[model samples]
Target: MSLSLNLPESLPVDVLAPDALEFDRGPTVSVPVRSLRLGRSPRTGGLNDEHCRMLAAAGEALPPVIVHSGTMQVIDGSHRVRAAVLQGRQEVAAVMFDGTADEAFVLAVRLNLVHGRGLLLSRADRTVAAARLVTSHPYWSNRMIASLTGLSAGTIGRVRGQLTAQTGPVGTRVGKDGRSRPVDGSSGRMKAYELLLGDPSASIREIAKRAGVSPSTAHDVRKRLQAGEEPVPRHRQVPPAQEPAAPERAVALPARSEPEREEPADPEAIIAALTKDPSIRYNNIGRRLIRWLDGCRRGVAECPGIVERVPSHNIDSVAALAREYAHAWGEFAAALEERNREAC
Candidate 1:
């Protein structure tokens, strides 16, 4: 039941913890330069030399870097550590963190995002990383990916759709909440069939509703029971329900023609296949982008740091360009997704 990432397990932290505990920040500790492990940085681009130089001049006055408790590898404050090294310091301040390696990487991304260096990755690199993460973490939603990468959810959704379409179908059942997990729907179907057997007057639709399956599937199950076939419940995770008691009264069923060969369509599978088309994916991305843009407009949301940073010269021009670029991003990601789907 552990959730493992496709990351190197060389670090001492747990690579497959089922759930990462809430992050705990331990008091600052000083470690010798020789003991420090320059942790693997997830930054797409290289470190900013100018930013490091500035931090070096500031010396130990800057905040301590964060390190994994077990591995003693630096997770944040890479530049500060570098600066400390340049300052000929034997020891630097660090705050030890206790968490899984995946959580450590996520924290690193957030730290790099707003610490004057901006995002440590280019937009294209970020997009690729986002798609890779979605494919690896099927249980994760687009919002979860966005939270870790600080990328738009629209982009994450497009990437996820592309990956799903490319891979055909995942074995696990995907629910409306966009999470995939093994499900047992069999016991409920068996119970429903038993109920229908006890009471010939029971409605098929009601049986289907109680069983949490499609009406057509319920009909098929009923037909099988009528044909004197012992019910073999499908092995799936079924919902909690009261076990149906076999009644003292049993009714004989009418003999019917051979059961129809038509199988009930799984709504989840059908929707996934339907959305594999290029046009549909693009339309989805565009709609989400438009919604995000609506919130970005002045009146819709509070002027965040991004809006505050708009240059003084030709304010409207920059705003217009940003809008166009965003629209273009939506279009590009959708089209790329379409290509991947077709390849699959």
Candidate 2:
């Protein structure tokens, strides 16, 4: 799930701030409940007494609470902490989170959304949480905040508009992959065009660095300029008075209209065809490859059912692993294609 960028050596590498996934991976320890301070919770109504009783009944089976190491503030699992107290436990298991209070709060919202055992955050609560996040993490893209708050990106976008109207607009947004991209790429494109006019010989990476855009974008600008076309694509070119709200709409509409474009070959048909090949059917390596491909196809086909069966608590971890495997498979496919090209 990592993206590679040809960024300048002077630019710092971006890493996601401490989040629920990081908290899940952190080491657990016994922290005295008395020593922990109750941090601000995302729940609008605060802790539910009935939920605490339910967790208390689970006794020692309750999972570790997440605590901010710096402030000794309870970042998540407040109900679990209350439950442990009702059980007369002196200390509860905890995972220490070393991050700012704002980051800890964001982690709390994310953990509450993902965990199955506790009462989920209400829609109103989630909306409030999303609004707070828009203020705290102004640079975070809508999808990134939406993923944490369990809201749609569109909802988050609306929330951002309402919140930022008072706070002012952000120039850049940091996406889930932790890369900061310009909110309005038109400016970046114009900058790139200017750079190209000054020195057409400049490398794409260098031009991108100076123009504050991605290398791919700089390359596009250079190509467009060379062709005597506008540096910014027509769809992306917005009047200075208006915001570029739907730059992708123009490009996306044509894709739906042209539905007659050929679809990919069916995986089952391909596998069946490969199985019938004499050279493949009789060879050990070929048979193994066919079996592997078939297994993958089956796995992909059953993804909906598989997702339904995944335990709620483990869903985040499972999804992360699945994405990692899918990325690896993409790399494997690319390598095999390279080998085939060499053979040809």
Candidate 3:
């Protein structure tokens, strides 16, 4: 049975509710342990023995597992399910929601990607899994899979090419960004051309909206018109007047120094510190490290900040720690290398 539910492309967050870890989650229910399924795919991963053991110890007190409302397929609890079965559990707690197989695949990939325990797969393996999703969810588009799976669109495209059925009916409007956009690029560009021709003196930005193109595109057309060329269709190919060919002079400007780039946080220090805590086990600490690192990695992905951005005063401590990251990172790496050699 196919279930229909709108799955958001971006990570959905509820502003009004404080405890919504994810959006569109359903109510919790008790499911038979034997009925529950594993949450990993070849693209994601299966349960770890250590993780299963930990969950088994948690018993009835373990956190609820997430399952698909349609198929009752587990989306994020392979370890927990395995543990319950091992512990002779009759039933396991689960949270169910409606979603497609494709959606489930992506959700599994994403959950594993950002989870505290993680998928435990190598980068290439993870990419291969995410890329395969392109074939399963064609409407999912290359970029959408890339974003959710944390793989590159280029990688996803390569995977999509390997599929037997690569083409399908394209109805849902997708942006170059791989997500839904305000307008389709083709129609928007055409509209921009129409609006540009309609009013030669109208505001470029305003015309861009009517034309369904970006303001920058409209501005480009304006500049072309100002340069004695037709903005839309080719009217006159030649310039009206040739300027007196003036000799160009080279001007030398003083070289400017730029501020040192902020260093990215090394997860090693955080990992080490968290691991050394007597209260937390190594496995639990590792999971927490993964969670924190995932957040930090995603935060730094948009680096080379947007131009004309306002300063963020609230995260001064975070900013300071980041600045000192590289220095401590070297020490952590060296120590890890030494420890590995000693073990070998």
Candidate 4:
């Protein structure tokens, strides 16, 4: 035989709050305990036993859970039921609320999301958070968020990428009147975006002005473009003008000079000295003697002959010395001639 248990009627949770609303109560709802209804989804996730134990320990009445009427979906407070069930609760108290499926989905997600807070981020919440940040603080750019969060600038950039990406590449550069102007080759989308974000007074026109291009040009180039056509190369934007080369100058030749003959110094003096002492070294001569003979040889052929310059006294002195050493030599040429004549 099974023990009979009495279960109270299910409570309905309204979207609008009746008495008071607190964060602990989960999403606010309208209606009393008597009018509450069961949520179709019954709220999922938060299925841990620890929460159930805590709820059981509290020994307090259950707070109301918000829900949508049409879909009977749980909008918030899924964990409360899970906790109660885990604690062997016979009856789970809840307040019913009325809302559309979309509203209920958002509310339920926000409620369960804030509970754990450490789970992997949901796509909807991430998108909502990003949208909220961008809308509330217009000055905060993706790069700024990336910087603070230590995420790649590209990551944050891609988050809000399509906002500016949908427009044509040329749209961002076009002026109000729709004319193309020159843009700085160095400017990038991130840089331009930063410029506008930093100064609220800045418009597309201001950015175009700083970029040194017409508003239209900046507009067109700045907008996102498709993959088909190649970007108009900036290098070809302006044709570089060319100038004529300077005429060549005539270089004059240097005049020719008479080549002087390089002669040995003191030729005559060196010859005479060598004759007197054939065994002597030439480098030991005095500088004056070298210089004097070198100067004299400059026009030696033009000078008068020196064949008759020997004095009789010097010749006689030289003959007497020769006669004194005659006995030390072989027969003289004159003696040989006399002997040949006698033989003839």
Candidate 5:
């Protein structure tokens, strides 16, 4: 009778040429022998002495287990086989798996590469590798790499920036709004700096996003580093205080005493005299004079009633008088016109 079994193509049943040559029967044979080399190739080796010893002890207690020879490779498990030989066992039982030497070498290298032991991947190195994988692997995409690694696509690009990328300062000061200064040179500034330090190709936008600021702000920080200065955070400048406008009209003085001056011809002259002599009081004569000159430019009658009645009219009084002057000037001009008409 014939029997058929199905197995995966990748996992084949016969790398057992050496074992088939050594034993031609389907049943176990007791052959008195010394340690015999099973296969040629450095890759294949036997188990350590400890494992062999344990297996031997177990065999003594129970029936000797049959070793599968189908998967054994001359190049693979060679060390393990050698260790079994060193233990002086008549037969070292092993289950072997096989592949081409070049394939095995490549597989080893790739495994080590992923673990970052045989190869050290810097930020730049990782980005470059990821980029290469993105190009080569059908299953890998930029977004997949980014999502898996928690890096932005732009940052990944920066991590692999050109070797000729120049060193420079970032642009703009950061603002409270989390935006960099509105300057053209400031774009991607910070990203460049961080990339230079870690992965030079790191995306400025990503860094800015992480920093809770706009890309420009991050770039400004980069500029600071490029300028050979420590980067300090910036804020808006406070505005200066404003000054008030000067008064338009001049202050009018109190009337002068008759002792030093003649009866003033005009109300202005009287006011000037009174104001110049600070000691002069607003007495009955002074009040009457003030009233008679009420039609004049310097008259206090047109002022707030309280200002006119207040006797202690001082500098403020003079200013009030000036205000009054301005207020009465038109009335005084009309009165002068009427008088002139009467005379005509």
Candidate 6:
């Protein structure tokens, strides 16, 4: 008999409840100790001998072990089973779990993390358990795995990064609410933007459904376009190098003071070289700096038209703001030079 058990709604705020597990929580049944199989234990160092001895001392007071109904494998109470054998017991009380082997393993990890009066799983053991779960349940979100393994969500995220480097990225993940969402929503937003542009009269829900995004995201995209902004926000947008050319005209800015060279350096070539460096390209701060620099490069190239478009009354204010930005950049460059000298 299959029983559906939804994760309790009373779980702590940090924990993300997973989808329901199938099990039989009916009356406990007696199963012969010798007939039971020892299932996989999340404990990398194996069962604690001291824990089994303590349980053995409890005698008949021992609680029922949870066993997988199909395989007669212990899912959550390996120590109890061991204690029963030590006590020369012919049979022990057991609750049946009707889930698959994978599900049983997951349940085992969850129980180990939360229950038992014995030694809790060590950090190494929990990490190993999380790594295994990442492999077996790629769709499970970091918080979901974190809740089960008793690891922080950030730790689980790092584990996911290391493991996925080998297995490749999971396109979608099941959120705490049990809904699957795309790992990256940029594509969905772009699609929604296109749909909205193609049919301005279409309902937000219709656009969202076709674009594979939430209705709220579709509405946001529509609002952004209406305001004459890009469909995706700046931080969330694709790298500047990959974006399509803007309609603004390009005009080279005045050259800065530098030592004479055989040939003038190409700013585009310099940017491309910086992008190829993994230390800069992959680092968050480095990437942000690159984006800023690229923006400045574009701004300088469009300055002629931008200057002409400035209203006569606001020109002084805009020029003052531009000078402040240039001063800030100069200070930033000097700081870098000072750091270089200090290193030397």
Question: What TM-score would each prediction reach against the true structure?
Answer: 0.44, 0.56, 0.54, 0.28, 0.19, 0.57
Best by lDDT: 2
lDDT of 3 by residue, 40-123 (tens): 464333445665776567534555676766666776667667877889888777766455666665566555554323223345
Error of 3 at 309 (Å): 17
What global local distance difference test value does model 4 have? 0.41
Please report how far candidate 4 places residue 70 from its true position, in Å: 2.5
Residue-wise C-alpha lDDT for candidate 6, range 1-344, written one tens digit per residue: 21223111111111122332222233577777777888477877777677587667754465567777767788767887888888988888777766577777777776565453244456677889999999888998887777677777778888998998676888899966688988777788878877877899999999999998999999998887676666666555557776543223322233444442212224553565455434456569979977988887887889988888999999999999999998998899689757644533
Q: List residue ranges in candidate 6 displaced over 4 A.
A: 1-25, 115-119, 196-203, 222-344
Candidate 3 residue runs with Cα over 4 Å from true position: 1-26, 39-45, 57-60, 116-125, 140-143, 161-165, 168-199, 220-344
- Runs of candidate 5 with Cα error greater than 4 angstroms are 1-76, 83-100, 106-203, 206-344
Error of 2 at 231 (Å): 4.4
* True-structure Cα RMSD, model 1: 16.4
C-alpha lDDT of candidate 5 relative to the true structure: 0.37
Off by over 4 Å in 4: 1-46, 86-91, 115-344
Superposition error at 108 for model 4 (Å) = 2.2
What's the TM for model 2?
0.56
> Model 4: what TM-score?
0.28
**Sequence-dependent TM-score of model 5:** 0.19
User: Candidate 1, residues 1-344: lDDT per residue as tens digits?
Assistant: 12123112332333223122112133566766666677466654456566577556643365667777666677776777777888888877766667766666655654543331222444554666676566656666556667555576667767777888754544445443555533334555677677787787888898888776667767877876776543443232233374333333333344444433212223332233233222333467745644454444433335465687878886899789878977987898689767644533
Candidate 1 worst ten-residue window by lDDT: 15-24
- Tens-place lDDT digits, model 2, residues 1-344: 11112111211111244443445445677777788888487877777787587667754466677777767788777888898889998888777776677877877776665442355566677889999989988989988887677777778888998887766888889887878887779878878888898999999999999998999999988877766666777656668576433322123212122222211335764576466434456569979989999998988989988878899999999989998998998899689757644533
lDDT, candidates in the order shown: 0.56, 0.72, 0.54, 0.41, 0.37, 0.69
Measured on C-alpha atoms, candidate 2 has an lDDT of 0.72
For 1-344, candidate 5 gives per-residue lDDT tens digits of: 11112211232223223232122123432221232234322112223344344433332322211222232233222333343445565554322223554333322222212221111112333444444433333233334344323346545334334321332223333332333443232223333444545754667687676655557666765655555543332222112232122123322233333332211233453354343221223246655555555454533445565465656637586777677876787688678657644533
Provide the lDDT at 89 for model 5. Answer: 54
